[model samples]
Structure formats: structure tokens, C-alpha cells
Target chain A: MQIFFSPFSPYVRKCLVTAHELGLSDRVQLLPSNANPVTRDQDIIAKNPLGKVPTFITDDGVVLYDSRVICEYLNEMGNGSLLPSGGAARWDALTLQALADGILDGALLARYEDVARPEALRWPEWRAAQLDKAQTSLAHLQAHPALLAPGRVDIGTLTVACALWYLDLRFPDFGWRERFAAVAAWYESFSQRPSLQASWALPPA
Target chain B: MQIFFSPFSPYVRKCLVTAHELGLSDRVQLLPSNANPVTRDQDIIAKNPLGKVPTFITDDGVVLYDSRVICEYLNEMGNGSLLPSGGAARWDALTLQALADGILDGALLARYEDVARPEALRWPEWRAAQLDKAQTSLAHLQAHPALLAPGRVDIGTLTVACALWYLDLRFPDFGWRERFAAVAAWYESFSQRPSLQASWALPPA
Candidate 1:
């Protein structure tokens, strides 16, 4: 198994963390990628038209993409219980995953506005609105402590941890920990998981 | 079930279309929304935090957001086969859905660039790059005809149809029909499904 990878991509990290949790990280090799919104990468685009990182190739030569799809495939392949099989448990976990991904999406857009778009064309309101997604989401998680209960390990929790990881990495001064202390505390403990701590980079050519 | 809706949001349309396919459209009520990237909707944020259209509430009082999770929930509720149980079929359908969603994401970004951003803040290169995602994806579909094979009614094909629908609605002069004849030809027939043809709107107060 292989995944098109970018060291700083939160989506790529989600897949890697998922693999690590499922005990399949050793089997999945990292293939470097230059996925960008404006300056698209043709190499990754050849496999995934989106030209996004974390696109995966199975041992049987099947291609899979987008972090959500890749994570599910890894779960199934490893026979992991990261995703619930059915019922409300399934929906809850999936919805939590969606929320976390939404936060990352907002954060990424804000990051792009700051760095990718030219300064003269940057929109402050757009950037602030994008960051507001994270703010609102953190408040939601802070108020609902059960959503991030201790020792709860699933795609939902893992994804939330990944979102925080990205927040710390990119928006270090966003000060979420001050306003959403419960969520901050949850991340303090939850992010200590070995899977979340594990890092990936492409092997030497 | 109910969904926070915007008439022109393709993600919202994807869920409605999925519900329509599963014969659950009648059961799902549409709630009007002013979901915008710059001006976030507080009502949606109350439930979803993402402040995006297509936030859903089930009969059991469970809330779900983002089209992927809601569509899957509706599928399970209706016992529909839009998503496969497992295996290659499941991955293929999912990846296809991801591709189509990626196209929509790019298209939406481009749309926002055109209308949401101030004229002085617009970046032509960024908008073109966003639209290019659709172009490359269409070329990919044209090459892989089986991905859009006839008689396919799964989420993947349905989403591709939705993407095409949006392209026609928003970028009428894109000329995809002339450029990627195979994809255009496939969509011409596949989109005629009653599910795709159905339109949705908020219920009268």
C-alpha cells in the first residue's frame, strides 16, 4: 500500500494516523506529493484528478482517494473498529469526523488566504470567516464533553485530534485553548496517543 | 427528517437527490438558509457548527451535517443501495463520490471568487485553477467510461450527474459536451433519472 503524501497536509496526516492506529502504517509507504490549489501538481493529478495528497493505492493496485475514503479502506483492511458498523453509533462517529474535517477545511482555506493568494487580493472577512468555523466548532466540542470523553478511540476522536494538531501547527496564536479550555484539556490528553504522535515523511529516493 | 437548505448549494442538492433516489424525499423537509462563506448562519451553527447548508436532523433528534454523512444516513434509513456494503464496489463508489465532490468544491470556490469576493480582491489565476479541476476531472471521466457506465444508480454515478447538473447551471458556456463527448453523452442519459430531475424547496410556513 502507498499514499501520495505531503508532510504538512492535515488530511495526509489523518490517513497516516489512521494507519498507525490500525497497525497498518508499516505497510503503507509514503509517496511525496506537491498538491496545491493554484499551482496544481500533475503527478498526483494523474492518479487523482483533484490533485490532492493522501491518495492511496492498495496492494491489489486499486486507487482510493480523499482522506475519509482512505481511512475507511484502512479500517476495513486492518479489520479495525475505528468506524462503527451500524446504528446511531455509526452516525455519531461519522458526524464527528465530518465536524473535525470541516474545521480543517476552514483552517486550510484561511491558511491559503494568508499565504497562497496575493496580498493585494486577500479578503480579511473571508479569512476571518474561515477561522470562525474553528472557533464555533471548538465551542461546540467544549460544551459537549462526552464527544471527547477519555479513552474514546475512533475515527471521530482521532479526526478531532488531527484538527487540533493542525491548529497548533498553523494557527499557533489562534488562542483556542484559552477560550475552549475543556476542548484544550481533552486535546492535551487525547493527542498523547501514540498514533497522533507518530509522524511520516517520504523515504529517500 | 429535515435539512437546512439553500436552493443553489450543490452539496445540499446532493443530499436531496440522494433522498429522492431512496424514495425518502417526501419525508425530508427543507428549511431555508442564508448559508454564506463570509456571513455565517447562526441557526446552522447551533446544530452543525459548520454553518453550512444541508445540516440534517433525524426523527430521533440526531443531527448530522455535510452531505456525505447525511446521504449515508438517509441511505441507511431508507434501506437504499446507493452505497455498497463493502469491497471494491464500495471503494469505487466512494472514490467516485469524492472526485465529484472535489469538482464541486473547486467549482464553488470559483463561484465564490466570481461573486462573493470584491472585484478588487478577485484573482483570475486562482479562479481558473479552480475551474481547471472540473476540466481535468471531465477528461478523466471521458477516458474511464466504465466509471460512468449505463444502468449505474449508485452514489458515485448520481454524484457525477449532480456535478454535471451544477456545471450546466453555473457554467453554461463551459462546452463540456463538445470537449468530453463521452462524459457528456453518459450524463445526458444518466441524469434523466427521476431522482436527478426532481427539484426541492423549503416548505411554506
Candidate 2:
């Protein structure tokens, strides 16, 4: 399989982490790629109209994307332990995945509001609004930090960890560790793992 | 199930449409709700830290949000026919659903760029950026109009229909039909269905 990838994308990292966990990392090759509103990479556009990375092309030539879906595909190919087989556990994992992904989305938008747009066109309220969603979500995770434990290092925990790592990369002064003690501790241990260490890159400013 | 909802949200409408299709509509009640940057609805926030609608409360007290997951849960409770059981059909439907949801996300952001932010802060480049995403996605759907057929009215088609309906409701002057005749035709026929009619609402100006 081949993947259009960026080292700094938290979503892409989530996919790579899933691959490592599934023992499929060596089976896939990374083709460094990037896509944005103004300059959509043709390679990504052909694979995913969203023009987003973490786009995967399976050995059989099946294309998949948007991290969550790609991760689920890999989980099935792997131990299938990342997601529960059935019932409430499945929903719990999936919902937590959604929450963490949501925080990442908001945080990315907030960054765009700050640095992507021209100074005169920047909207402080919009930026604040996006950050508020991330903060509220972080607080929720802090309140229930048990989700970050070893046994819970499924898609949800991995995603939450990735989101936190993104906060560190993009908004370091956000002071999440001071506010989310349990979350910070969980992330501290998890960041040292080989897959995360390999995937880490300071996202472009 | 009780769903914290807002009529204007296409995501919320997608959930209602799924309920109707699954014969689960009557079993769920809509508690009208809205949340955003300035005024986050506490009820929504309590259930979903993201504070986005289609926030759902199950009878057993489980909460789910972010449309796709809610739709899956409803599908499982219903005939289980909405999502293909397995294989290529499942991925096709899911990837299509993601694409349509991306269009809705872009359209909503473009609308916010116009009305949610102050006029002086409005960024035409950013607005164009978002609309371009929607347009690229719409062209993809147009090329695959067969996915929008009556026989294909699963989560993907429903989401695409809801997205097209949103463009109609919010950006009447956008004129998607002139460019995507097949998609427009599919949507025109699909829109009159009872499930869609029941879920339709005039979004706030």
C-alpha cells in the first residue's frame, strides 16, 4: 500500500500509529504530499476529492482516507483490538474518536485563523471560538482521564494523544498541561513511544 | 432516544432522515437546540463537549453525536439495510458520505464567513477557499450521480441530499444545477420523499 503523507499532520500520524500497532508499517510506503485550499496536490485530488492527507492506496489499488476510516480498515487487517467488536464499547471508542478528532479540527481552524489569513482579514472572535471548542473538549478529557490509560490506548486514546501533541506543536502557550494534569501525565509517557517519535515533525508556521 | 437538535443544522437533519428511513423516528424526540462560539448551549455541552448537534441521548442514557456515528447506531437498531453489509459497497457509501459531509462543512464555513463574522473582518479569499472545496466535491458527486439514486438512499445519498438542500437554503444564488445536471435531477426527485420533507426546515437567516 502507498500513503500520501505529511510528518506533521496529526491525522496522518494517527494512521501511521495504527499501521505500526497493526504490524503493517513495513507493508506501506510513504509518498510525501501536501494539499491546501489554494494549491491542491493533484496526487491527493485524484485519490481524495477532499485533497487531504493520510490518503491511502491499498496494494489492490483501493483508495481510502480521512484517518478514521483508514484506521478502521487497518484495524480490521490487524488485531481488531483498536476498536471493540460489538455493543457499547464500540460506541464508546467511536464517540471518543469523534471527540478527539473534533478537537483537532477546531485547533487546526484556530491556527488557520491566526496565521493563514492576512492580518487585516483575521477574525479574533472566530479564532477564540475555535480555541474554546478545543479547550472545552480538553477539559472533558481531563475530567475523564481514565480514557487515556494503557488498556484504553485504542483509537480513542491514540487520537486524544495526537490532539494534545498538536496543541503542543501549534499552540504551546495554550498551557494545557497546567490545566489538564491527568491528560498531561498520560501524554508524557505515550509520547516516548517509537511510532509517535518517528512521526513527529514541527508543523509549518 | 432524545436528540438535542437544531432545524437549521444539516447534520441534525441527516440524523432525523436516518431515523425516518430506519423506522426509528417516532422512538426519538427532537429537543430543539443550537450551539456556537458566542453562546454554547449548556444542554448540548453537557452531553457533547464539542457542543454540536445531533447530540443524542439513548434510553439507557448513552449519548452520541457527530452525525455519522449516530446514523450507524440508528441503522443497527433499524433494518440494518442502510449501510451495505460489507465489501466495496460499504466503503463506497462511507467514502461518499465523507465527501458530502466535507461539502456541507465547507458551505457552512462559507456562510459563517459572510454572516457570523463582522463585515470588515470578512475574508473573500477564505470564503472562496471554502466554496471551492464544496464545488470540487459537488463535481465528484455529479460524476457519480448513480450513487444518488432511489436504490442507493443510504447514509451517503442522504448526506449528499441534505448538503445540496443546504446549498439551496443558504446560497440560493450559487446555482449548482447549471453545472451538475445529473446530481440536480437526482436531488429534485429525492427531495420530495416523505423522509426528506419531514426533516426539512428553513434555516435561520
Candidate 3:
């Protein structure tokens, strides 16, 4: 399998972290692509018309994009180890993953609005609104930090960790750590793991 | 099951349409809620920290939010009637849903930027950027209308309809019909269905 990746994307990082966690890192090869929201790569557009990164082409030529779906497929291929086995636990984990992914989405858009638009065209209100959503989601996660337990190291925890790491990379001034102490501590501990440590190398600013 | 909803939410409309199509509409009651994103609603926030509408409180009292996840749960309850059974088809359906949902997200944020922010604070460039994403996604769907059919009425088709409906509701000036004739035709026909008609009532302006 080959994974189309953008180094600066937290979504791609989540997939990579999942790959490492499931011990399937070597089963897939990563192909770098410069598919931005505005300037989409033709090849990436062909594979994923949405022009988003972390599009995974399977060994048999099956194509999957959207980090959540791809990570779920990878988890299933790895025998459901990264996802909880059944019932409410499974839904909770999936919901948490979705929430974390939502945080990343807001943060990415906030950052994009900052850099992608001209200075006079920048909307502080819009950026603050996105940040508000991110902060609220982060607070929720912090309140439920136990959800990030070792036993609960499902896709949810992995993606949440990745989302925070990206914040550190792009919006270090967001003050997420001071506000979300529990989640911050949880991510700090999780960051030390080999999978995260290896993937910690920052992409270009 | 009780679904907390507002008449105007595309997300809520998606769930309502899914329930009606799956013959589960009668099983899910719609409760009124005023959960505006700008003004936080504690009651709704208790159910979904994100405070988004279309939060489904199951008979078992488990709350599910986010239209995509709620639709998946509804599909599961009806014996996998809406979603594709498995394999590439399933991923394709999901990816399409994600794409359509992406359109909604962009459109919604643009609308919110226009309405909720002061004119001086509103950024036309940022709004244009989001509009561009919505337009691109719509064009892609237009070019690949086959993905809308030749299978069960999956989440993809459902969301594409929702996205078009949203565009019609929010951006009548976008003139998507001129550029994406096929998609506009598809939505026009799809919107005529009884299920869709029932869910088609516009939100408050």
C-alpha cells in the first residue's frame, strides 16, 4: 500500500501515528505530494477529487482518502487492535476520534485563513470563531482526559494527540496547554512514545 | 429515539431524511432546540459538547451528534439498509459523504461570517475562499454524477442533496446550476421525493 502524504498536515500525521501504533508502518510506503486546498495536484485530484492529502492506495490498487476512513481501514486490516472491539465503547471511541478530527479541522482553517488570505482581507472574528470551536472541543477532551488511557489508545486518543501536536507546531500562542492542563499532560506523556517521537519531526513552516 | 433538531440545520435535515428513507422516522421524534453556535446552549452542550443540532438521544439514552455518525447509527439500526454492505463501495460512499459535508461546512462558515460578524470584521476574501471550496466540490460531484446512483441511496447521495439544498438556501447567487447542470438536475429530481420534500423546509433566514 502507498499513502499519499503532506508533511505539514495533522490529518496525515494521525494516519502515520495509527500506522506506527498498529505495527504496520513498513507495510505501507509514503509518497509526498503538494496538494493544497487552492493549488491541487493533478495526480492527487485524480485519486481524490477533493484534493486532500493522506490518500491511501492499497496494495491491490484500492484507494481511500479522508484520514478517519483510512485509519479505520488500517485498523481493520491490523485486526481491530487500535479500535475498541464492540458496543458503546466503540461508539465512544469513534465519537472521540471525530471530535479530535473536528478540532484539527477548525485549527487548520484558522491557520489557513491567517496565511492564505491577504492581510487586509484577514477576518479576526472568523479566526476567533474557529479558535472558539477548537477551544471548546479541547476543553471537553480535557474534562474527559481519562478517555486517553493506555487501554483506550484507540484512534480517538491517537488523533487527539496529533491535533495537539499540530497546534504546537502552528499556533503555539493558542494557550491550549494553560487552559487544557489535563489534556496537555496526557498528550505530553503520549508524545514520548516511540511512534509519536519518530513522527514528531516538524514539517516546513 | 428522540432527535433534537431545528428546521434550518442541514445536518438535522440529513438525519431526518435518513430516518424517513429507512422507515425509522416514526421511531425518532424531533424535539425543538435553540442551540446556536455563537451563543452557547448549556442544555444542548450537555448532550453534545459541540452544541450542534441533530443530536440523537437513543431509546437507550445514548446521545449521538454529528450528522455523519448519527446517520451511520441509524443505518445500522435498520440492518445496514442505507450504507453499502462492505468493501470499496462502502468507502466510496463514505468519502462522498465527507466531501458533501465539507461543502456544507464551508458554506455554513461563510454564511455565519456574513451574518454574525460586523461588516468591518467580515472578510470577503476568506468567504470567497470558502465559496471556492464549495464550488469546486459541487463541480466535482457534477462531473461524477454516477457516484450519486447505481446503488442504494447511500450517505454520499444524501449529503450531496443536503449540500445543494444548503447552497440554494444560502447562496442563490452562486449560480451552481449554470456550471454544474448535471448536479443541479440530479438535486432537483432528488428533492422531489416525499422524504426530501418533508425535510426540505428552509431554515429561518
- Point to the candidate with the largest lDDT: 1
lDDT of 2 by residue, B1-205 (tens): 9887777888888999999988888898777676775567777887899888878988899988679889988998886777776677777788788888888888888998878888998888778878877777778777765667556778888888889889999999999999988888888888887889885443354
Please identify model 1 stretches exceeding 4 Å from their true place.
none
How far in Å is the alpha carbon of B201 misplaced in model 3?
8.2
TM-score, each model?
0.99, 0.94, 0.88
The full ranking of all candidates by TM-score, starting with the best, is 1, 2, 3
Encode model 1's per-residue lDDT on A1-205: one tens digit a residue: 9999899999999999999999999999888888888999999999998888879999998889899999999999999999999988888899999999999999999999999999999999999999999999999998898899888899999999999999999999999999999998888888888998887877799
Q: Residue A68's C-alpha lDDT in candidate 2?
A: 75
Please write out the lDDT profile of model 3 over residues A94-180, one tens digit for every residue.
Answer: 777877777787788789778875676666766776677778888777777567765457887888888888888999898888888
Structure candidate 3, residue pairs in collision? B8-B203
RMSD of 1: 0.8
Error of 3 at B130 (Å): 2.5
DockQ of each: 0.92, 0.63, 0.40
How far does residue A37 in candidate 3 sit from its true spot (Å)? 4.2
lDDT of 3 by residue, B1-205 (tens): 9888788789999999898888888888777688764566667767667667877888899877678778888887877557776677787888888788778877887897788766666667657766776777777777776776533477888888888888989898999999888877777778787778885333354
Off by over 4 Å in 3: A37-43, A200-205, B35-37, B200-205
lDDT of each: 0.92, 0.81, 0.77
